[model samples]
Target: MVSKKQRLASVDALRGFDMFWIIGGEALFLPLFALTGWSVFHFGHGQMQHTQWHGFSFYDLIFPLFIFLSGVTLGLANKSLRGLPVSDRAPVYRKAVKRLFLLILLGVVYNHGWGSGIPADLGEVRYASVLARIGFAWFFAAMIVWHCTLRTQSVIAVTILLGYWLLQTLFGNLTPEGSVNAWVDQHVLPGITYQNRAYDPEGVLSTIPAIANALGGVFAGRWLAHHSGDHKAILKGLFMAATVSLLAGFLWHWVYPVNKELWTSSFVLITCGCCLLLLGIFYLVVDVWHWKRFTYIFSVIGCNAILVYLGTSLVNWQYSSKSLFGGIAAALPQQAAGTFLIACGVILLQWLVLRFLYKRGIFISP
Candidate 1:
């Protein structure tokens, strides 16, 4: 068996697997339906995109999965920190605060930077971002784990989800212009909404429920860490929790609807369910069955996911792919095949870059 560090491989692999879609791999499927003209490809391609409103899709699950994974890691991180003397806690707290602001700063630059003319375009830029949401939600969840027991943390998560549901149901109008979400963004944030027009998918009020998603991840991490020895027990509990979460989400969906943009309570439950199920499968395979070799590629990407993601955005891998391999892809007869080839080449190029870093034992992380 591997050491304590190796135990984290499953988590890292799972995280990388999720990041695959975000890092251009999802584009690989866009043209697949065109080439095959099969119902399966068409259905999958549709699921790959976000639903316009009030529905579930595979694409909708990616962001929340990141939040959930952070929560899981936080449980492990907090447990280690708890062992330190009280005097040592302050520095860790300070570091976390620094990391928080750094993430917020990065989010700011990502939305409005030198490319967008900096401060001149800041007023119209979408300030709220996926990174900002992850930072905020994970920061709060980390703080909560430092002080609260597992039971208390779980209670807090449930309360947030249920409370948010009640509030939205009572006051939410469920319209683009009239919904409480849009009203708050337009009223409080003004032009800072996504597209600098109306509402942000990762708006302020919606983050309250998002915190619950992270908390659910914390619970998963805690359970896994606690049962690290009894493999059978760990699998059983994970599967059971996944089932319960799935059932609760669908039951609540009738009233609240699983809306990703809103990050609805039901959406939280369902996505967490999917993450749990995925993690359970990964754990059983990599950790129990000892199928470690196949997951190494994912582990490489997951080790520095944040850095690679930011790098992709700043470097504009799309431009690189177009410049370097565009002709190669263009040779294909089917446009769908051509598009899929471009996406494949791009992702493969990214993997090669990441692989080089892995071989050199270099990783950029925050």
Candidate 2:
């Protein structure tokens, strides 16, 4: 079995890899797209950026995947919790709750401020978001793990997903266009509508499926903890995930539309499938094949993911780069240079923070 410390490296590496995209994936790619003169028509739409009403995208996968990984990490961290006395478990549970609240609070601060030119409006700021969803999911998933056996938790997860599908289809009101999207948004959340009277990425109804995403990770984590050394177990997980994803995508497409914004059942399954596939690859390559050095770079960012995420949110590292690289961007005619410079600057700033945290042994966790 892998030691807890060794498992931490894998989890951190995965977390860092996921956040790298969240922080600047689009910015990094936009410059390339500009240089290629690709039609902005397809790229400009929020669907390309975020999902429309009910669809999937590369962007939509990031947040949920992170949450899923969080569940896996929590399982790995708390594997020994089962052996501990009730007195010992209480403190751990309290700490987990505290961390969840702290993550939600930080997410609010990030959404509201970060010193961007955009005016700070707490009232208008979105109360619910990707981070908030993750926090809630993590808290709930942890509670399930703490209280129930792995078998029972798995049953509960499946029940929630099925129940949510039924509720949305039968109970939800239809929109003017005869869509359940708006109806669920309005009625499910009640007074807490979307931030701009538009849509809520972390809406009430969508959270049901989101919980499944986290629980999927919990299942994976429990499996990992118990069968870390069994090569066949990893293969079994990968195969099972792929099968579930395909079936869910095919079946749910008939009704829910596989929308990432809605986080429909199909979307959750597909994304979780992708996540499982990726995790399997990492496990095979790093753990089984023993690819150590290359994984370190991604692992470093993973180790201090929360710090870099919050720091990037709060501080405009672009300003610091503008002092040096911004002038260089000015020399170029098109916006490409400016975009590239900003992207590079953000990457460097993130790396620097990660490096500093690594040196100081400071890691922020939720």
Candidate 3:
């Protein structure tokens, strides 16, 4: 049997792969559209960009995928803590709280906290952030997992989805200013919202539905834990659940509409389904089949995801990349070629930084 203390390679690789897109991996392929003018590259480029309002895109999947994976880690962590005394769990809870607030604080920093010196006014800060959403969803989902049985957790997940849909129907429309989420953010959130708009994608009300994504990951993690030794069982269970989730999501989209901005019920269902599907494939190839070599880069990045995520904001990686590789890009025959080369250089530099941390066992997580 696989030891609970041991990490799942597939999880790390999948996380790094997801983070890849966030850290400009999309640019590597995006420039292809301009260079070759191929329909295929155009389609790939389209997939990299988020849907404007009320649709799904591959880019939309990235945020929830990370949150879902965070839930999976929480589940596995809970499993490891199962046999411990109640008193021993205190530090675990404390650490969870610390991680939650830390991520939230860091999210603030990512939103330009102190970037232009201190904000002259309290309202200058944008408190809603991607990392903050992850922290909130993971924290609430962890609380549910700590208290509830699987069946109860399942019920709660349903309640959250349905309840959010019902509330949206009653109080919110799809518009930026009219969204119930916008109202919530304006009234409750202390500082500025995203782009100083009425609605923040990671705002107060929208976060309620995001918890379902984390819970879905918890369910996946539990399934993996239950069938740790049975590879076939794991694949079958994951695929079956994913199929059901996808069907449900599509069906609900007729009414609620799948949207990443509001993070509607349908959006949560669809993204969670895709996440499960991706996790299943990653597990099959990376873990079940033991294909470990190619995944090393992803594993390194995943090990220190938060670091690179924040690094992109705090550090001038693009400047550094251009400083080192600008001449190389300039020497390329075409502007598109130069753009692609610079993108590659950016990723290479980020990977080297991650590799350095990975080799020295310097992983930093929330």
Tell me the TM-score of each prediction against the true structure. 0.92, 0.84, 0.95
Which order, best to worst by TM-score?
A: 3, 1, 2
Query: Which residues of candidate 3, in runs, are more than 4 Å off?
Result: 1-6, 80-86, 114-116
| Preferred candidate (lDDT higher): 1 or 2 | 1
Clashing pairs in 1: none
CA lDDT, every prediction?
Answer: 0.80, 0.71, 0.87
> Over the full model, what C-alpha lDDT does candidate 2 score relative to the true structure?
0.71
What RMSD does each model have against the real structure?
2.7, 4.2, 2.2
**Candidate 1: C-alpha RMSD after superposition:** 2.7
Best by lDDT: 3
Question: Over all chains combined, what TM-score does candidate 1 have?
Answer: 0.92
Error of 3 at 246 (Å): 1.0
Candidate 1 per-residue lDDT over residues 30-88, each given as its tens digit: 58777777788777777789978898999898889988998888765545455678898
* Highest TM-score scorer: 3
Give the CA lDDT, 0 to 100, for residue 363 in model 3: 78
